[model samples]
Target: MSGTSDLEFFNTQLRSFVPPGGFDAHAHLYRREDAVDALPRHVEDESGQVGWTAYSRALERWMGDRRPIDGLFFTVPKPALDRPAANRFVAQEVRPLAGSRMLLMIHPDDDPADIEAAAMSSPCVGLKVYHVYASRADTFNAAPGEFLPEWAWELAHEHGWLIMLHLVRVRALADPVNHDYVREHCRRYPNARLLLAHAGRGFCGQHTVEGIEALRGLDNVYFDTAGICESEPLKAILRTFGTRRLLFGTDFSVSEERGRCVSVADGFLWLSEHNVDWELSEFGRPTLIGIESLLALKQACRSARLIDADVERIVCCNARQLLGLRQAATNQTQVTYRRAKRLIPGGTQLLSKRPEMYAPDRWPAYFAEAQGCEVIDLDGHRYCDMTTSGIGSCLLGYADPDVNAAVIRRVELGSMCTLNSPDEKELAEVLIELHPWAEQVRFCRTGGESMAVAVRIARAHTGRDRIAFCGYHGWSDWYLAANLSDS
Candidate 1:
């Protein structure tokens, strides 16, 4: 009854990609009485309620066989809605669904004690504060602190609960105010997990891309792929945060709706059946918003070079970890390797270090920290260096104390300047002293660039382009040309 015409679309486009036993990180649960205003037509159920059963049935219609194992449920945070009733409804509905969790819809004016009492009474895992709860009529432009009071942050920090924030402001994360708020608050409340809904409300895509840098090192922050119909923002998230930090969310009832939000100049516009004439389009027709979101996610994952395991993390494992639910143990090294293959050509910058060059999937392709001859991997396992020893570059061993001290001193004093550093001249003089036959010296950052320069100088001096070369000199075209018979 649900998927109907879209069943073909789902089967053809998403059936294989949509892994089973996944979790929905974001979804809504409530009844008619919870809202003072009428519910959206798509979510209006004949049973006078839209709980787990209704949600499952609706999901079955559209998703077919690829149903989520459980979901993080919340209620519509309309300005005039009865908040207590909504929370009660969600709590009652999800009590039987194992692994399903709910959040208490909180207003800025609500008492912290009541909020805490509600959380204690119910199985609510966190707080869901909305922009509509702000005191201003134009809540869209409301500052973060106006709707989400400091007490909520303090309470969440103390209890280690999550705060699902749907960011506002015309430019979303691109706005300096929004960026500062997220950075400062997240840093201040280290224990509270801040789940940014809709990928930082990245309807414009550019907003998320531009502002994602500000949130780079904030480990407590995370994002949800809920109702975003574009790939750019999702790609930006995956690239910046990697697979573990990005969670899959349907935005549920909104996902069931027929229109989507598209980026316009500087802002975004929601194109729904009510706003646009579908008959006038040259394209066939609009699919469900949820379907469009999945398509965008699929495209982003493909573009980001995510493997199946990476997809599983986004769709299922990440949420389980966030919710404290038990999940299958994953090898962090292998996971990082799979991600590397997708993001990096040959899974590494150096051909010698490629995972395929050694033990393949079993190789430790990355390290979290390195000291002397021992290296620590992402999973916290340590190893002794029996191989290249930092590809022979770190002959002094990784993080040698003398080298680190010099680098740190230079960095602290400002490593770069508009003018050349005197250290360059001193280093060149030292090199010249080492080789008495050479009076002048030039420097290049890498061996490849230096080899190219050397080739250019030799060719210029002798007026000859051809020369005999041997074994693994560099990546310069001059060195690579040996493979070509014509060359």
Candidate 2:
């Protein structure tokens, strides 16, 4: 009863089933002692009592509705002592993932050697650490600094282990120092791939852009969606880094939040399309929407994350590249042309977006072939060609013999040349004749070229070698010199 875009379609499965051995390295599993104490705080008053049985029942119901969520991460509910306690807790909650399914968590100060030994003794498909919890606990990190055991890196790196750290932007933690620690950890174990949970946790900002920028060079870093509610900061992060470095994470633990986890994720569904608006999304679970909505949502994601290639950098390539995971080589290329890039950089990028952020991704396809004033798309879609050959491009109708002849003549005459064509001189003459006051006519084919030429001209005319630009004005000194120039 649910469409592809409907959260119910996905959540229904999540409620009924778990992913086949999929692993979530960032969930929390408190001891019964702790669950009894903590579950009450988060359990929705409407979901019934908050006890281990109730929590377990709710979780099982969700899992049974959804099953085998690859694996769910369960952080230690504090009050853990020594490796034995942590190991015992894992045995009770996470050790179920013996062969392939895994749910792993590592406290910052937990001895990595014990964790390694436990992995050897049992199966731990993935590992997680909680910075968000730490923040709530009033600590800058979930565990002490350099939380990874000395040998943890060596062991995890050697085994191609997938490590997850709940690294939030807890105002105080996202720093050069913390980034350095992570980078150093990565450097120590070259094969170590780490996913930073919550895309570095910007809930209320214990940090700033400067903090995120601090880790610019660390290629091994990754971000997964959790509590992220906005696409703008995510867009900036994707742009600052790359969309490939991003992973789709829904901290589904928010089932206790005001809206069901499905509702929250539904709010994010618009992020999947090219013409959606989150404001338009249905905010509830156990309810079905439609496929058109889903397609629209994903369409937006395809672009919002890419406009500046930031989306591509974050959502698709970066995580796989850094983690050494391979994606299904997509035959489809989300190539945004020069015009789109001029505005949206990677073409209006965001991790979660509305379809409108990416409609350009499907231009002619969304509309059928243009016939004079009309055009249509594959889905029996239709639209008006408002500008029929208005730009003299034979576009959207107006293709006549005269236009054809003119185009053929230009082509045959070789109007485009490696060097400046005589056509340029003739065109300049016509322009100058028309204006009379104009002194120069610059011939550039594309926006990028024109922009570069314009900058060069301005710099020459003003005798000021320095300049500034904000958007995707490539080929300009302001852009090229951004990382190099004295500016």
Q: How well does each candidate superpose onto the true structure, as a TM-score? A: 0.72, 0.47
Encode model 1's per-residue lDDT on 1-487: one tens digit a residue.
Answer: 1358777789889988889988999998888766434345556578778889888888888788787879999998787788998899999998898889999999988999999999998878899999998988899998899899999999999999999999998899999999899999999999999999999999999999999878976768999999999999998887666677799999988888788889998998888877898889788476788998999999999987688988988998888888787554568989978988899888788899886777878778888657667676776455788899888889998877589779878987999999999998999999999999997898998887887788789889998777677778755555546445673
On residues 350-456, what C-alpha lDDT tens digit does candidate 2 reach at each position? 32232344364554323323334444343323455554343345553533436645776887787676686576688899999999988988877787788778778
After superposing candidate 1 on the true structure, give the runs of residues whose Cα lies further than 4 Å from its correct spot.
35-39, 327-487
Error in Å for residue 454 of model 2: 18
RMSD of each: 11.6, 18.7
Model 1 RMSD, rounded to 1 decimal:
11.6
Candidate 2's TM-score: 0.47
lDDT of each: 0.86, 0.47
Q: Candidate 1 has which clashing residue pairs, if any?
A: 3-61
